[model samples]
Target: LRLVNMRFECVGAIDLLEFNICNNVEILNCDFAPADNDVVSAISTVNSSWLTIRNCRFSSPATDNGFDYCLYAAGGSNKNLHCALIENNIFDGMDGDGTAIHIEALCTASQTVIRNNLIMIRGAGIGIDDDSDQAMVIENKIFHNGGTPLDVNASLSLMNMLSDDGTVTWSPTIAGLSA
Candidate 1:
């Protein structure tokens, strides 16, 4: 287990973390820097049995990325990826096209749980694409994006999305996303 926050760098500073990782890690109150550079250095590519991201804050306003979607899962998508937990993180202030605002799994990522995250993006909130299955997204607040809140274009069996207040709604605008 590990944790990172304001103490790691100057306030409003930008940093990047890259590598293949394992084990449990937490990021909180970390204002990803370069202040609108769009280049996301703080990313993880992993073969780990499990991964967890919590209480982090990412801000970018460039065309490249304040976030990257493809790096999180080297395996494939939600269906093939293993356990991952993302909780209470904030991805906002992005003006460009990021990799993803939240999570994108082509595999399924069994036992995957995303809870209480706040995502404000120029495009895309949480996207689970390509034959994914069985994920729980609960208590997340998403708003003001060029795209939908939760976008799942594949298949799922027991995927659940709950608002912070414990309520949800399904929409017809998106193919297979609810609440």
Candidate 2:
């Protein structure tokens, strides 16, 4: 773990760090907030490999939230093991009212790079279920979500450039872009 700066509060069910089975691991510039632990999986790597999380910031747990995943991985599916590189992280205010990043159900992440992150919701910013494949959710800026910003049921074809508007969305029929 190459965590820099640093700030973590009310943590539980933790995976602020986990490089299971293990390989090249590095989580940099860290900050985790308000965690309570809601386990199903939290950074698993029964047979891990090259993992990297940069500029980290996973939040929300002090009193009203729990983690399903702030980062996760699991048993290798069969072939070229788990290869990860999560970049520029800032998954804010996770409360399990919104799950946060989970890539498991049998791993195979190649050139994985979830870029420019800021998942703002309660339950999902990333999730790749069973038999995972080439992963890369680019330029992330996910939005207002009590849920469902993303929930990949996992096949070899999940793609996201998700931008849920970042917050000024309520068009009851025109007159707001900053009228």
Candidate 3:
């Protein structure tokens, strides 16, 4: 219940912000726009923990629907979301499908930390489903997306720490990432 520097604009497919079982929830410097185009999720948290979205800005509904996720952290009955920190956020234009950021936990989500964000989206980027565990995606700056910025299916130690210092950019290329 601690929303700081708030600015939420919703006209149509609205869900500018949603919460549940609030813990240390802190959304700082917020600016979210869910202006129609159906399929909504500007920011959503179910079974919340130490959820902290920093320096935020998100705008969804560009093309597709299926509820474009600007930021959604939904855990299971165990409410596994812990130590969550989505840092320095700036997830721009996402308009189709989904996956600007979606963390689905069931068996894991112990130290969920997605760092230094700046994603210019088209849909599908950063999805940590399949029973998330010690997820820590670091130093992010994804561009012009069409899936696969970091889609870890989780389990079996899928701790892919991608660091070439390029900050993740892919325009037309998608095959293995790195452009």
Candidate 2, 1-179: lDDT as tens digits? 35567665544554544544666767678776554544333344555567776887766544256455666566444532356677777776555453556655456666666566666665433322223545655545566544566544233223344444444432121344342
Q: What pairs collide in candidate 2?
A: 4-29, 34-60, 34-61, 34-62, 35-61, 44-73, 98-122, 98-123, 99-123
User: Residue 153, candidate 2: how far off, in angstroms?
Assistant: 16
lDDT of each: 0.48, 0.54, 0.63
Q: What is the lDDT of residue 136 in candidate 1?
A: 61
Q: Which ten residues in a row have the lowest lDDT in candidate 3?
A: 155-164
How well is each residue in 15-111 modelled by candidate 1, as lDDT tens digits? 2554455545555555554444444435444454466666676665553445544224544532233577777776664434443333334544567
| C-alpha RMSD values across all candidates | 6.2, 13.6, 13.0
**Best candidate (score: TM-score):** 1
For each candidate in turn, the TM-score is 0.62, 0.26, 0.28
Q: lDDT tens digits, residues 45-119, model 3? A: 777678788988875545544346787667677665677788888776456445677777563467777777776
Better of 2 and 3 by TM-score: 3
* Candidate 2 Cα errors over 4 Å, as ranges: 1-41, 46-69, 74-107, 110-141, 144-161, 164-179
Kindly give the stretch of ten consecutive residues in candidate 2 with the minimal lDDT sum.
Answer: 168-177
Q: Which stretches of candidate 3 lie over 4 Å from their true place?
A: 1-9, 12-15, 20-33, 36-41, 44-69, 72-80, 83-99, 102-108, 111-120, 123-133, 136-148, 151-179
Clashes of each: 14, 9, 4
